[model samples]
Target: MTNKLKAFIFPLALTLVSPVTLGETLRPEGLLSLRELPIEEGSADIQRLQITDRSGMVLVDTDKALPLIENEYSPNSYDGYTAKLLAERQTKITAIDLQGERYDLLSPSTRSGDYLLLITREEGNGAYNFNLRFRYDATAKSFDLNQVLLNENNSECDHSLLSTYSIDRKILGVISIANFDGRRVFGVLKELRLAHQTSGNMAEKLMPETVASNFDAALKAYKVGDAQALKTLVGYFLSGDEDGDCEPGNYIVEKYYFPQKVGWSNDLGFLFEQAGHYPEAVELLQHITRKHPDRVVAYLNLADAYWALGEREQARQAYGQYHEKMTAAQKQARIPPRVLERK
Candidate 1:
């Protein structure tokens, strides 16, 4: 692995999470838990972040069939409640804006231990009350939070359309998946804001917030197909590594006072690859191979990266090794006419 790849992975992996304070009043936001009844598990992307105990919440834009747009547009004219203390569960989540229209929240949890927000609204006849239940998970150290309806269902345990997480004992940071490309950019912006809040006025000194924002922005750049941000994030990753390995900067994370985890590594690698950080991508893929020797995606991707850099021999070797494990059908399914065009 190269020093750059090491740098890229270390800080991110190491900067796990700290207890985040949610609600607009607290500023950058954190965990969520709706208690009255229970919110249903709608989708996997949302459910992926949700464990048995904690999960971040996001409002799917029912109108646009998208995640909430991150534009500077004003919030909806819908009258609702913004509470820091507690939320009621007697209300119903409309087909319109379920989460945000019903509730608005921060995305990633433990983003440098920043402040988060929650905005809940009731559509049409706001007769029933809403209880947004949020439970904290000390193990993963996140939260399980969701929307709840009070008056529905039988005496059953939250079988209604309440928002519930599958996470176990981990505090969940309310989050959303905007259109992948569009959303990543918005997510990076949110990341910067959270870092700024968590920096505790150390923005200039530790230059605290710049690091993560830069990392995420690079991902966003690639998402929109922006080459520069992609490269910069790659270079930043490289520069951070004095030892050419992906570490998530756990050292710095510990030194800087933050939580740590292997979370987001593959995703981070994906951003690097999308941004054309092939060598860095290769290093990241290699990192994953150490743990999951059977993941063909990593090897296939790494080989491609090697080939892109004119390292034909290395690429061939990687491809051959991974190809051995692939079924003939799998290989045929994956190959494109362009692959045979390799020089």
Candidate 2:
């Protein structure tokens, strides 16, 4: 993993006329619609979406946040389509259709725009979930082939859903999620340019060693309170060329996606918290819980930040959840009781 500035290259963006050359692929006639999650069964606002294209209609999957469209039309390849997504901030179900399908939709004629992939839960029980697909495309930009993905489901009901107009978002999160042996939420890299490769099982065969090597240099610079070094490292994070498949690159990827859980903006919050930027930490962490309820950890950490800032009840709520995530044996491994006491 030589960091001597690997001469990187970005791919050309796809044109509307870019040949859809897989000969056997199905022609998309109408708009395809998907949802984030299903609304409560009996609620007045039963959520749904209606997908139709300028020509006709595409397939729809009701309950899945990401739907895999099995293509009988394509041959000799894993050719299918999914309106896949990851959890994120400021999520809204927007609408639902009679078929119990949730949709993050746009007008039938809107050509290219970025879309937010979200999920909606039934208001009452929070039971059935559906995909939330919203268009966020810009002129000329198209859908990414790799959708939001999770390395492991970590059993966290709500996971972070991240999306950037870029293709490398998930590669960086690799380290952060692995740290807690937990799952992190991220959108997939459908852009052919990124070229991410995945396996049914990928916890092993980690990223190359060089990514870590660069990360170590950056971290050392960070510890010494070097703002310039921190800026450079942070620059690597926000860049579009990260990969989780190698080492220092993996380290770069991980820290970029650090605070690694899915509930809220914990990724950003963690960085702020570490720097004693409590106000920002509280604000960002609170954004996660308020906007994304499934990120249980955000609530707990929000409490920590709140307590640190001397905010009581909010801290208590966070501590309450934190205690539940702990075990009886772990509890006895004792720190002060009130270290987590809300009040």
Q: Each candidate's lDDT (Cα)?
A: 0.37, 0.36
Per residue, candidate 2 scores C-alpha lDDT tens digits across 296-322 of 556556777888788887788777765
Per-candidate TM vs. native? 0.33, 0.27
Top lDDT model: 1
Alpha-carbon runs more than 4 Å astray in model 2? 1-267, 287-300, 328-343
lDDT of 1 by residue, 1-343 (tens): 1111111111111111232234422222333432111112221111111122124443221111112331234433222233232322112122112232322222233222221122233334222223333333334444344432221111122121222111211122333212222233334434443444455232211112334566567767767876775766666544333434433332222112211223345555656666676766666666666666676666677677788778998878777766666654366566544344442
